[model samples]
Target: MSERKRFYLTTAIDYPNSRPHIGTAFEKIGADVQARYRRMEGYDVFFLMGNDENTVKVARRATELGLATKAYCDEMAQQFQDVWRALDISYDYFIQTSDPRHHEGCRKFMQLVYDRGYIYAGTYRGWYCEGCESFKTETEIKEAGGVCPVHRTPPVERSEPCYYFALSRFQPALLDYYERHPDFIQPEPRRNEVISLVQSGLQDVNITRIGQDWGIRVPFDERFTIYVWFDALLNYITGIGYGWDEERFREWWPADIHFIGKDITRFHCALWPAMLLAAGLPLPRRVFAHGWVYIKNEQTGAVEKISKSLGNVVEPMEIITKFSSEAFRYYFMRECPFPGDGEFSWSRFAEVYNADLANNLGNLYSRVITLILRHFEGHLAGSRAWEPGEIYEEQDLEATVQQVQGYIENCEYQLALQRIWQYILDPANRYADRKEPWKLVKQDLEAAARVLFDLVESLRVTAILLKPFLPRTAERIYRSFNFSRDWQQVRCEDCYVYPRPVDDLRCLVRPGPDGKLAPLFPRIEIR
Candidate 1:
């Protein structure tokens, strides 16, 4: 037997200061899809996700809401869990930075680095955003009045004695790591950005901040709380039983991929790795920084960034309610490549769903199943012997199966779905144009049986390939055929073995009267 491949993946822990929006949900869904795909491919996969609760942002938001910081964070963290469940995210571990285990892990790691002489206490002056819980350089500070850009609030100039990590000490080591692993930071553009930043220079980063009572207290220094980013980044290890379960830690440590948004690329790709190197831990294998979602105005066609302050945040629950969780997931992944920005338009979503899901995919399945029951007495027909010259059907199935394998392996899910649909479309068009059932009952029963048998096999193949993306739909398709089993075991070639019949066919998407249907995708009118 071949050795089992191992994959440990994670999405950036979301800050619990505010409720999550589509952007955060997108990252989780994307990472979840990849993890599921890996598991289907027979890999030992561990996917981690969690909340970043140790920040002044949470404290300030709690203060604004007139609640204690822990209470506010706890409430917000539940919201995160709700969204994840609604989205069907399958994370192996959902960590919270406020967990006692996390605090212990953070302290231990900090102490290890401190004992290694990488951390020192010093007074540093800088522009600070209590809302962001991090210091900003002159250039990083956007507002002329010293307001935090993200919060749109003024920041105070602060000076305090805090524990600082000698990030500069690992500059050469980081450069060497990058040199050895070219794909460590992914999508080529992000890797180049990291390289440029590392080549430019490095600075010692403040790992602890004084006068912040909302975060993990620094080891041996209760006067200073560990900085938000530093404390939050440790969740990756803390969630995997680091500093507790040595065997479990050894099993999933050094994550295979760290999926993060472009906005926080610097923290994950730059600072986090330096911290890991300092602690003598293996670094994450890759950091993939994905871009944002742009919401375009319906009438003007002008695009704007998604922001809560602008009241333009598109909630995933709202979309899932309007459409479906599967549709929402399919649209997001299929609409854009992983690394590029995608525009979310109501019109575009309607077009894709109506054309792809409602009409092409759903209609095709319904038609095939309906025809099978009508023509074969509500049962699948036996496989007839192929004529001496008939090899095209077998060859075509083989080629399409190969295409499915390649498309999924490359993470081109849209292309994979299209390839499967192409097989369905070809036979569907032939069945419609030829009217095989009508022609065969009178003229040739064997010929019509052959056509229907081929169609059934094609439907089975389509459902199997679609299991990863549209699991619910795939299950419906499988149930329509009286098979209830994992999709991985079902192969197109194996469909020939079971010469069974399917009865009691139902419309996957029932069409309305007048031989017409209402628009499958209604426009999104945000209230």
Candidate 2:
């Protein structure tokens, strides 16, 4: 057998300074879907996610709570894990920057660059934004009215002894890399932004901070701590056994993709790649910067960023509880376009949940099962008449499989779902309406059997297609048919061809013993 193609993917680790919001969860969910799809396609995949705990912010928060920094991080790490667990994120490993392995790996990686003559000691003075944990340019400060663009807080001016990375040395090399691989950064617009910034000129960046004791001690100088960005970026490789396990590291060193929020594009696209080049390591194949989740301000009727100060923070768990996790996943995937920012409103969310899940998907399943039990007395006698020869041919099911695959490959999740919902689900429902299987049973028994058979098989294919998106709901629909004994795996087969042993309807869709099945998603009344 040929070697399995290796694929390593990651999402930017969370800061763990606060409870994660829906915006944070959005990146995780998107990455998880991509990972699931790759696994289905038979790639050897490793997905990594983690938390960034080596920050002065953690120490500050600890002081407020009268706890040690490590103690606070331990507690906060659990909180972050709880959110990931709730979302059913399928990450292979979760790396904490505070981990001993990570510290050793980061120090080793830094030393490799230093020995290469890419790092040097220097004294630096600049305006530092504590919220961002980076020095801001004068232009950036002025644009935000003398405050940090993201936090709206004034930066503190500080002069300190530091170690700087010679990122300036890689200016030509970076431009050349971009020229050779135009697709390094996604969405074209982000690529243009990174290119423009690099072309303007490159500057050496401060890699170690002075008089800060809350983080990993610089290897050569114990008095200083590694800067948060430098430390956090190392987790991507260190989590995969980079420093210690050469054999394993070689297996998946160059990540296939790094998914991050748009705000951090500068670091991931420019700084991180330059650091890797300095270490004589391969750059990650791609960096995708996804947009934020903007929520509406209730009183002003204006869109606003979701933040603590605005009190516009949405509690993801509250929404997940009210609407199941399946609905939550479907809403975000279907409603949010991946390339652009997504808007969130309680009214829009409720509207989508009721219309798509409860009305479209839930109603279709309930109607199909209910009619089979009522008219056929839980027995479907499979005959040649039931074969969906022309109907299947008309649906062009093969093309749909290709369409969905293409959309996923390009990370166009919303488009893929829209095709499934509009083309697949809507057409199947309309077929039911045209045949009127309930009425057809009295007019022509064989004709009615054919209609129900087509509907049942269509649903089977839909459940398979839906697995990576709404896993729980898909399995529930699958089990309702009682064919759990037939197919042990969740996979997509040729749309027109049914998985065989189709001699009996009872074999395909076994009706519940009581001729009744529970509702999939009960309609919720919007107050």
Candidate 3:
């Protein structure tokens, strides 16, 4: 009965040059998990994701395809959204940087920062990577042995007339801000890296590019277009009615978290906040720099970045089609550590799927539901009086819920899932094995009913905890029983803090053509 607090989060907009790989989807899935968790905690959440279309690659790729620039961006945007939707990324808005409103807002913001003396005209000569569409600093080039770290290719030296943002001027202020807010850059290692970079020195960055007409133009000078990074970063504000809807923008301007990849922490944590400070806007509360998803060379036992040249890039849709949205979500969130690097291999995927989902969680669900349906015709007598026992004997219910909550709040997704399986669900499976509920039904009818009640309770608890991570599967699990509360209305703390009592206590899931409830997670065959 209190007002729901607001939570706004955004992921880095991807370049529309190519289809998104599993590596790209990794970041979105992590952000979606957090967004869903916040909603479950009763926050008014807004999730934003999009494509960065105002880059040189956009036009070049479009030209290669023989399509007009805008048409290409539109088509790619649809393709990107389709993949994200199919993966069940619950983003509220998808901003295309080429939108008229985005262009208008970017121009206005640039002009404001320009008038404030942070912007100046200059000539920039630096190592440039055409793939990333940005200038690389000497430090970056040297560390990576005279190549752009991301592209892993030598950056061309070029000179161009441009407008620069006076980022060096904010050096002292940025350091102070970091000192004051240690939590601004998440996962400790990223925070230290950002601090070290800013402490080394800040450089005034080129904000406008000449001889480019595909991007938003610098308002005062029509001859130059805005740099893609500068333009792309504005998506967070512009996507949420920044220049157009003042009332709406004010409500969500200072985002709770900017969910970006570890590669772009410098952009989000340093350049982004400085730009906001220049415009006198509040910075986003936190920037979470999540790790990458690499492809494991199963034979060689080596791990490498997902790249087309490497011939190891795995598309998100490839796995989503092969399995399911929930299965896709579960594999990454379970196998991959959220704040660190993870590897994906077909054999590893099958192993995790069968061990965690099929053998443990799904197997438990089928046996419990089937046993209840077969013996009691899907109704358990006096289930309302059933004192649902502990899913974990070592910890009480509230303590158990708190432990999972702590992992989620810190974005320790893999750990949270491990806790669920190892503590909550594993114990439930153990309980079934220990009691042998199926055999009890043949002799001790009343005792068997009690055992089924506890198993069903375990499933209910499991569903509530998994709702945010594995949404569709969670809904299916929750809807199988006649829980008193509505599925959507359920919250993370509901499992312990205020568990609603069961009512009719009858199986609500529809039986398949085989006259039996289908398996929630069918065992994946390892070929």
- The most accurate candidate by lDDT is 3
Q: Write the per-residue lDDT of candidate 1 for residues 1-527, one digit (tens) a residue.
A: 23588889999998887778887787887787778767766788889998888876777788999999888878887889888888888888888888889999899999899998899988889888776777887766764546777676777798888888998888889889999999788768888898899888889998887776777888888898888889888888888888677678888889988988987887998899999988999999888888778887787888878887666888888878887888888787777666767788778888777777777767656556555555556555453443211323665666776776666544455576677666655555555456556567568766666666555555666666666676667656665664434455654344334434443223333335753333323333333
State which candidate, 1 or 3, has the greater TM-score: 3
- lDDT by residue (230-349, candidate 3, tens digit) is 999999999999888878899887999998889899999899999999999998989999998999998798898787888998898888898998888999999999899999999999
Better by TM-score, candidate 2 or 1:
2
Candidate 1 TM-score over all chains jointly: 0.87
The segments of candidate 2 whose C-alpha lies over 4 angstroms from its true place after superposition are 377-379, 383-395, 482-488, 493-501, 507-516
Question: Model 1, which residues run further than 4 Å from truth?
Answer: 1-3, 142-155, 384-443, 482-527
Relative to the true structure, candidate 2 has a C-alpha RMSD (angstroms) of 2.4
Best by TM-score: 3
Q: After best superposition, candidate 3 residue 408: deviation in angstroms?
A: 1.3
Give the number of colliding residue pairs in candidate 2. Answer: 0
TM-score, structure 3 vs. true? 0.97
Screening candidate 3 with a backbone cut-off below 3 angstroms (N, C-alpha, C), the clashing residue pairs are none
Candidate 3 residue runs with Cα over 4 Å from true position: 1-3, 386-395, 498-504
What lDDT is reached at residue 153 by model 3? Answer: 94
